[model samples]
Structure formats: structure tokens, C-alpha cells
Target: MKTISIIPVIRVLSWIVFLGLCIKAGAVLFTFTISLYNPPYAADLYQGLDLSILYSASRLDYIFLMAFAIILSSMQAFIFYFVVSIFEKLNLVRPFSEEIFLLISKISYFSLATGGIGLLAHQFADQLVKNGLVIGKAIDFWEGRDAFLFMGGVVLVIAQIFRRGIDLQVEHDLTV
Candidate 1:
């Protein structure tokens, strides 16, 4: 009987995530470009469905919206990159090394950072509507964004635990 290593599973899942994020980024770029440039054609091609993120936006607004998606996707992909890093960093050697904790800690903060940006965007939307200032701004976030902020706090605590573990490991090594 042989034991199965989990590293391969981790690697496979990370690859799936990486591919998914890339597809999403590419889709945003392609769809927004086509729909913005040729609205009627894109409607016919996509069965009358468009990205919908830039609904009610003018041509200039659509351009800014695409720029926003590029920035948003870049940030979103960064989180996945951190996930891939964690998976790649985990192995038979130094599984709990400083690199892992540092990476996780970054994941924690970046997750919170994204969530915070989403929150701010929402607030800005509210202000615009309240002021009757039609800036043609349209933005939204995942339902899980608030949850991401909460999880970031939890991960920060966990990173502190790992910091202690590193210190303890150092002490233990010194004693031997």
C-alpha cells in the first residue's frame, strides 16, 4: 500500500484557478472591446447579451470601464497568483518556512484590499445616486467580498501563529 501525496492535487487545483482567471481576464477584454466598438454586431453574435457591466455608459465611459476591468482583473489575478505560490511553496522541505507565512499574510491583506476597494466603490455609487450626479459610473462586487474582509482578519491571526511557530522552531533548534 502506498500513500498518496497531496502536492499533485494542490498543483492541479492551482492550475485550474490560474486558467480560470486568465479566461476571465481575456473575456473581459474581448467582450468589452467588441461590444463597445460594434454594439449591434456584438448583440447579434452574443444573442443580444452583452457584458452588461457598462450598461448606460457612453463610449468614453465604456473605455474607462474597460480600464477598470483591466485593473480589477489584475488585482483579482494577483490573489490567485498568491494561491499558486502557496501551493508551489508547500513540499517535503520546510513546509512551514518563513516564505509560506509571508505569502499567506500577503494573501490575507490583498484579499482585504480588494474587498475594501469594492466597499469604497459601493459607497461611491451611493453618493452619486444621492447627489443625483449622473457620472454614468457602474460597478459592483461579489457577494463574498465582505466575507473576504472577515477572512483576511482570520488569516492575519493565523499568520501571527506561524510567526510564533518560527520563533519556537528557532529556539528548539538552538537547544539541540
Candidate 2:
């Protein structure tokens, strides 16, 4: 039996995920915009906030936010590819250098840390807004557990990133 290369598989999966995220983001933006124009719906939606005032804000704001989220999601996907690449490259090398392996490990650790921080911030803000708490006050609710799931998600992804790094390192060491 022949083993297939993991890097190509990961790249394909990353592209698929990125495309799916793009589609979802587009649908969300469309729905949000349509909701604004429908009178009865718009009245209910904009009860406290002024519809005209919100619409007057640049459409680019929404576009930019969506784009940023897409970019972050894509980055998470690419982290998978990165691990696969490391593994493939390690297999090609007769024996991996300890220094290089250490560097790779450090890089993975930092990437995971950064992603975790970002995910935490986003989840915290989202929960604050979702629980009927004002933004300023919600932010104060670090004591709040409403966003525990989101925090868990961040931790889960970070753990995955770390696992990938460890797997790549092991594969590299064993292949030679």
C-alpha cells in the first residue's frame, strides 16, 4: 500500500473551507442588508438604534469586518497546511537538526498563542452583545460565563495547532 502526501490534502481542504466561509459571509451580509429595507422587520430590528444612522455608516465597515473574519478563518485552515508541509519536508531530510526542530516548535507555539488571544477577544465581545448587556458593561463582565463556549473553541483550536506541531516533529524524527 502506498501512502499519500498529507500536504496536498491539507491544501485542498484549506481551499474548500475558505470557499465555504466566503459563501457564508456573503449570505450573512445579504440577509443583514435585506433586513434593513423591510419596513416591519426594520422597525423591530432598529427599535433602539436609528436605522438611518446605522445605514449611514459606510457599507465598507460591514465588508471589512466580514473580510477580516474570513481572513482569520483562512489562516486557521492554513495552519493545517503548514503542519503538513513541515512533515513532508522533514520526511525528505535524512535527519532533522535539533535547532531547526526547536525553531519550528517555537513558531507553532507563538502562532497558537496569537490565534487563541484573537479568538478570546472576539468571543468575549460577541457574548457581551448577545446577552442584552451594553457593550461597555458587558466588557466589564469578565466574571460572566456566557462566552465559555467561545473560549473553549479558542482553546480547542490552539490545542489542535499544538498537536499538529507535535505530530510533525514526531513524523520528522521517525522517518529518518
Return the top candidate by TM-score: 1
Tens digits of per-residue lDDT, candidate 2, 56-162, equal 44444333333334344444444444444455455444334444354355445535543554556457457535644333322231222234334445655655665
lDDT of each: 0.65, 0.46
lDDT of 1 by residue, 24-84 (tens): 6776667766766676533322223343433444545445544555555556778788889
Residue 52 of model 1: what lDDT? 43
Question: Against the true structure, candidate 1 has what lDDT?
Answer: 0.65
What TM-score does candidate 2 get on C-alpha atoms?
0.35
Query: Which residue pairs show collisions in model 1?
Result: none
Compute each candidate's TM-score over C-alphas.
Answer: 0.72, 0.35
Candidate 2 segments exceeding 4 Å error: 1-61, 92-95, 98-103, 106-114, 120-176
Query: In candidate 1, residue 55 scores what lDDT?
Result: 42
